[model samples]
Target: MKLTVVGGGSTYTPELVDGFARLRDTLPIEELVLVDPAADRLELVGGLARRIFARQGHTGRIVTTSDLDAGVDGADAVLLQLRVGGQAAREKDETWPLECGCIGQETTGAGGLAKALRTVPVVLDIAERVRRANPRAWIIDFTNPVGIVTRALLRAGHRAVGLCNVAIGFQRKFAALLDTAPAEVHLAHVGLNHLTWETGVRLGGPDGADVLPALLAEHGEAIAADVRLPRPLLESLGVVPSYYLRYYYAHDEVVRELRTKPSRAAEVAAMERELLAMYGDPALDEKPALLAKRGGAFYSEAAVDLAAALLGGGGSPYQVVNTLNRGTLPFLPDDAVIEVQAAVGPDGPVPLPVPALDPLFSGLIANVTAYEDLALDAALRGGRDRVFRALLAHPLIGQYAYADALTDRLVAHNREHLAWA
Candidate 1:
């Protein structure tokens, strides 16, 4: 099978390449294309990708290109990891919302809205191009604001599914704690992307006995540390929240912490520079240890599994993916994109049944789903009013003054990205 990575120039690409190399049995790729408009970075990453594949004795041919249509042409799958405005755009997304006294995250709040606006149109264009090249090719989105982007793709009627590393990361960590294989630890992962909870941890399969309580009883503090939430909070909720939830559960504190530190984008920018320098080394054949610090833990594994499943190469039947909810969650709109465990196959992902949720988690899921609706609205049909409404709707920026100000800051910082502005 052939696979193409749209943002193959990203520093994150090497990790993905490493996974593809390591998991050859699951996804046997004959041709791997790395497509990026940034020619220089693409070559650097592409060279490292080939070396990583070679180091593992995988013979898949690696190709690099600046052309999108050509890169995806005749491919079995197209994976998107692009950043429209690069780290500079992300820095703005990470900084402006903080000025509004709100969380400056890339996937939620005002920052997330700005990212959604900038990303949605670009991703749609790529999806259309991929569809034109190969209508059967599946588009696997690893982009930020994945729910909005994946929903946009589905709305446009593209063959697509969204992938995130959060679930896989949790699976690996939880499995290690449980002293079992990662695949054996099935999470009752629910809610929208980034705003999810593990209601249960079953073994073997979805129907396996739930061992969440025992796991929590023994490793509550460690799990809490990983999520950056207090141990007491985990015990109180009886579930483990994704780290992103920290932004919502403690918005003010997160804003304060963000204000004191350099934006994550800034740190990533520095890391990218070093990573690029390292990539230039011809002798470097493996993903560096420092890349782990760059984040997206287990991203490669997740991508491999999703690609394998979608291409019929073979993968775990059940996976955590972002897809149309249909009616899995009684409260969410049928069209809303939710991140949860699903039965994946060559056709696509069909979300498994989600048990009734607590009002606490369900209420937040409903609220964010509403915000995402507005976020997608502004992204599809840009206007200051629409942007303002999305910010206003976000639980983290509910106050009118903050929403109004954040809208202005978002527009001002992202005017070049927004055609309507």
Candidate 2:
């Protein structure tokens, strides 16, 4: 089977490439294709791919191309990780939302919404190409705002699945924080993309679901103690979820117990600047070589594992992913993309019946969906009016200002992002 990586030059590409190459025997991929609009990035990833194959002694052809159609031809799976307008554009995606004063973190808040608006069209185009070139291929999207983009692709009628490292990574981290292995945990994750709450986590083995709440209550203090570490979802749910908890739980109940101070957003910015410099430096040939050498340990292996389980006749049950709400989330609008359990196979994704959200969780779900609709409208029409309306309608935003004042602030602060599309 052939696999194509849409954004071959991303910093994470070598890791993913190396991961798949290392797992060649299990995944059974016979060829690799790297696609990118940037020639330099294509060469960088292409070179890395060659080195990875050489080390593994695999004989598959490693093809790199700027031609999307050529790269996607006959592909079995396509993984997309593109930054459509690049970092400057991403900066705008984030910064403009923050300028408007709503919780503007990319991936969960207004910033991510802005990104979805601008990125959907590009992803759709890629999906269109994949459909035309390889009708049976599954598109694996690892792009930011994955929830939104995955929905967009599905709406456009493409075979696609959205993958996020945060959820499982959080599950693993929470299990570790509770001094147990990941397999020992049974998690019930719900809600929109990044804003999800686990709602339930139980011991994985014979004891069943009853043991979880007591365990969480018992470990809540210990879990709360690590609050500043990022990935607040697990912590909020009673274990420290992942490295991103600090950002999500900054305003949560036990945040005061955090052992460390959350780093400023500027720190995230600095890291981006460093990555930008690395990408722009002309003397980076040696860098790619070093990266290639460590490629065998790349993070995409988990995804490969999931793929193998689903396709290698392992008969792993269908898993939850992002999809239109419809009946799955009764309180949410039918059009929203919700992450929940579903079956997976050549027939494609099908959502299972998701239980109704408890009142508080349902309200939170509504708030998140309201923002998503706002971002979707903003992105589709390139207008801030819907964006502002979204904020005003948000639980958080509504708590802070009157509708008139909210619109005025949104207009005053987001003048740059709100211009005509």
Candidate 3:
């Protein structure tokens, strides 16, 4: 099978290449294309990708190009990981929102909405190109604001499934804690992308016994620390919230923390510089250890699994992915895209039935789903009012004063990216 990675110039590409090399038997890729507009970074990342494959003794041909259409043409699958405005835009996304006393984040709050607006149109255009180049190809989106992007793709009738490393990272962590293999653990990952909770941790398979209580009893403090949440909250709620929830559960505190620290974008920019330097080293074949500090942990495994399953390679039967709710959660609209456990195959992900959600989680999920709907509308049809409405709908920035201020700042900082502005 052939696979193309749009935005393959990203520093994260090496991690993905490493996974593709190690999991070659699972996916068996014959041709791999790395598409990026930034020619310099593409050369650096592409060279490292080739070396990684060579070092691993994998014979797949690795190709690099600035041409999107040529990169995607006739490929079996296209993976989207592009950042529309790069780290500079992300720095603005992470910093400006803090001025409004909201947590500064790339995929949540007003910052997330800004990213959604900038990203959705670009992703759709790329998807359209991919569809035209190879109609049967599956689109696996690893881009931020994944739920919104994936929904846009599906709504446009593209064969697509959104991939996130959160579930796989959690699975690996829970397995290590439980002293089991990663495949032996399955998470009842529920809620929208980034905003999700591990409601159940089953072993063996989907129907396996739930070990979440045991996990909490054993690793509650550590898990809470990892997510920056209080251990008592996990015990009280009987579920583990994704780290993104910190922006909600402790909004003011997070805002204060964000204000004190340099934006994550700044730190990542520095890290990318170092990573690219490392990629330039001809002797460096394996993925550098520093890449782990750059997020998207276990992304390679998740991408390989999702792609293999989608391309008719028999791999894991069930995996966590972002797809249409289709009533998996009775509270969410069927069209709402949600991150959850599902049975994976060439037919696409069929979201498994989730047990009844507690009002606590369900309420937040519903609220965010509504906000995402407005966010998508604003993304597709640009206007200040649509932007204002989406910001106001967000639980983190519900106040009129903050929403108004954020809307103005978002539009101002992103005017170049927003055509209507």
Candidate 4:
């Protein structure tokens, strides 16, 4: 199979390459293309990718190019990891929102809306080109604000599925804590991308017994600490929440903490420079340990498995993915993209049956889904009012004062990206 990575210049590429190199049997790639306009980073990442493959004794031909159409042409799958405006824009996304006394995050809140506006247009153009190049190719999106991006892709009639490392990372974490293999721990992972909760931790398979309560009783404090939430909160909710939920469950505390620290974007930018320098070394072949601190933990494994399953290679039957709700959650519209366990195949993911949800989680999911609906509107058809309305609708910035201020800042910081501005 020929697989192309559109944002292969990213520092995250090496980790993905490492996964592809390590799991060749799972997604036996014959031709791997790295497509990015940033020629320098692409060259560095591409060279390292080849070395990783050769080091592992894999014979896949690695190609790098700046041409999107040329790179995606005739490819079976394309992975979108592009970051519009790069880390500098992300720095703005993470910092400016904090000025409004909101948590500064790249994938949620006002910043997330800004990213969605900037990203959706670029991704749509790429998807259009990919469709023209190879109509049958599947698009696996690993972009931030994945639900919005995936929604945009599906709405545009692209063959796509959103991928996130959160579920796989949680699976691995829960497995280690439970003294079992990652595949043995099945998370009742639900909700929208980055807004999900592990309602149940089942074992064996989807039909396996739910061990969530027992796991909580045994390792509740550890899991809560790992997620940076209070142990009592987990006990009360009886489900493990995504770490991103901290921006909601502990908004003010998170805002205060965020204000005191250098933005994560800044740290990642510095780390990228260092990593690129390391990538320039001809002798370095394996993915560096520093990449672990760069985030997207287990991204490689998840990508391989998802790609494998989607392409009819080989993967676990029921894995967590972001796809259309299709009535999995009665509260959500069928078109709403939700993250949950599904049986994936060449036809794409078909979500497994999800039991009725508690209103506590369902209410938040519904609220965020509405915000995402508006966010996508603002993304696809730009307007200041629409942006402000989306921000106002967000639970994080429901107050008019913050929403108005955030809308102005978002537009100002991202004027170059927003054609309407």
Candidate 5:
């Protein structure tokens, strides 16, 4: 099979290359293309990718290019991981929102909305190109604001599925805690992308008995620590919230903390410099250890599994993915994209039925879903009022003053990215 990775210049590419090398038997790729506009960074990352593949004795040919059309032409799948504005823009996204006393994050608040507006149009253009190149090629989006981007792709009628490593990361961590194989542990993953909860942890498969309570009872403190949430909250809710939830659950505290520390974008920029330097070393044939600190844990495994399943290659029948709800959560609109455990195959992800949700989680999910709708609106059809309305809809920035201030800041920081501005 052939696969194309747009934004393959990202520091995260090595981790993905390592996974492709290690899991070669699972996917059996014959041609791999890395597409990026930044030629210098592409050369560094592409060299490392080739070495990683060769070091593992994999026969797949690795190619690099700046042409999206040539990279995606006739490929079995195209993976989107591009950051529209790079780390400098991300620094703005991470800093400006904090001025409004809202948590500064890339995928969760006004900052996330800014990123959505900048990213959706670029991704749509790329998807259209991919579709023209190979109508059968599946588009797997790993970009930030995945739900919004995936929704944009689906609404445009592209053959696409969104991929996130959060579920797989949780699966691996939970398996280690339970002393079981990763495949034997299944998560009742729910809610929207980046805003999800592990409602249940089942063993064997989706049909297996739920063991979430047992895991929580024994390891509540550890689990809470991992996500930086209070142990008491987990005990009370009977579910584990993703780390991103910390921004919502402790908004003021997170804002205070963010104000004191350097932006995550700054730290990642430094890390990328070091990673690129490492990639330049001819002797470095494998993924460096520092790459782990760069994040996207278990992304390679998730990508390989999803791609294999989508392309008729043999793999698990069920996996967690971001796809349309289609009534999986009775509370969400049918078109709302959600991350949940679903059966995977050549036909794509079919979301499984979720058990009845407690009002606590369901209410938040519904609220965020509404905000996402407004955010997508602002992304597709740009205007100051639309931007202000989307910010006002967000639970974290519901106050009018903050929304007004954030809307202005978002536009000012991202004017170059927003064509209508």
Candidate 6:
């Protein structure tokens, strides 16, 4: 089995690799390929994954390369984890939104729009390459702005699935809060990609609804207090929510704070510099002890684990991922790709169904449509006006006329950076 990891130099590469290494018995891997433009980091990770595989007595060929064609050729599955550009570009993605006086966050609102604009073309380009090279290969995408990127590939007509650890990770957290086994707790999720609510969680069978109301009522305050956001969402729906709770649950407060404070873009950039300083060069004289403190498990564990499962068809129910708006959210438009609970096999992914969404949750689902519509429109038309309309139409931004003005300023200031046509 050939598994190709596109963004093999990513900070998360180690975790993903470890995930496969630990699950070797479940899904034996035959060959692992790490592909990244940066040869130095690729070498480091390639050596590391090989060492781990050897330690586990797995006989898989590990190859690292900068060549896209070489990396993807004859591969059964390709895990795309590219950042398009990396953290430096992410700073610009965030900063551009703030300059326009809109809430300057990385994954949503104007920032997400900017990212979609820059990322869609690159993702589509890669997908097309893979399609031409290997017509039946499954593209397992792990990039951020996952929904946007996945939809771009799907619309462009490719075999792709979006994956995220956030939903599964948070589900475990909610299980702990409910004092139940993670597998015992069944869930139904809705909305777009990272931004979504767990519309339902049940303790056992189809009758899982019985446990939801009490679970939410009991943990409501704790969940809200933990994130410092009014997380009435899951509670209102009688379930638990996850992923960027601090932002969505209290969008009002977060929005207000962004308005009152100086843009944190520079501060965030500085922080990124510090992180890169610590990790960018392993040979640097003073590697942060904290860096060493990070276990090898996080290094190459998760990606490898997923790779093994996808390749070997591990029978165990891993929270493998797929992107489709069809089943998990029948209420939403069919093309809206959402990261939801998926059962993976040698064939591909089988998505579980999304439960009925509440009116507010349903509205949030519709809100995301505006963004996707504009993004798909931009990609098809090669223009930014649709993106501008997308920004103004976002439920959060459209609520304020001032936000609209700020968006205008943001586009103008970052016109060159946005590379808008």
The Cα RMSD in angstroms, rounded to one decimal, for candidate 5 relative to the true structure is 0.7
> What local lDDT score does residue 247 receive in model 1, on the 0 to 100 scale?
93
Superposed model 6: Cα runs more than 4 Å off: 178-181, 204-210, 231-234, 256-312, 315-322, 327-330, 399-420
Over the stretch 125-205, how does candidate 1's per-residue lDDT look in tens digits? Answer: 899899999999999999999999999999999999999999999999999998999989999999888999999999999
Give candidate 5's whole-model lDDT: 0.93
How much lDDT does each candidate structure score? Answer: 0.93, 0.63, 0.94, 0.95, 0.93, 0.65
Checking candidate 5 for backbone clashes, the offending pairs are none
Q: Write down the TM-score for model 1.
A: 0.99
Task: TM-score winner between 1 and 2, please give it.
Answer: 1
Candidate 2, lDDT over the whole model: 0.63
Q: How do the residues 1-421 of candidate 5 rate in per-residue lDDT, one tens digit apiece?
A: 8999999999999999999999999999999999999999999999999999989999999999999999999999999999999999899989998887887899999889999999999999999999999999999999989999999999899988998999999999999999999999989999999989999999999889999999999999999999999999999988999999999888888999999999999999999999999999999999999999999999999999999999999777899999999989988889999999899899889999998999988899999999999999999999999999999999999999999999999999899999999
Q: For candidate 4, list the clashing residue pairs, or say none.
A: none
How well is each residue in 1-421 modelled by candidate 4, as lDDT tens digits? 9999999999999999999989999999999999999999999999999999999999999999999889999999999999999999999999999999997899999999999999999999999999999999999999988999999999999999999999999999999988999988989999999899999998999889999999899999899999999999999999999999998999999999989988999999999999999999999999999999999999999999999998998988988999999989998899999999999999999999988899999999999999999999999999999999999999999999999999999999999999999
lDDT of 2 by residue, 113-231 (tens): 55675577778888999999878788888887877787777777787777665556555666776788766665666677665665566676323463446655576655445444433
RMSD values for the candidates in order, in angstroms, are 0.8, 5.5, 0.7, 0.7, 0.7, 4.2
lDDT winner between candidates 2 and 6:
6
Relative to the unseen true structure, what is the C-alpha lDDT of residue 163 in candidate 2, on a scale of 0 to 100? 69
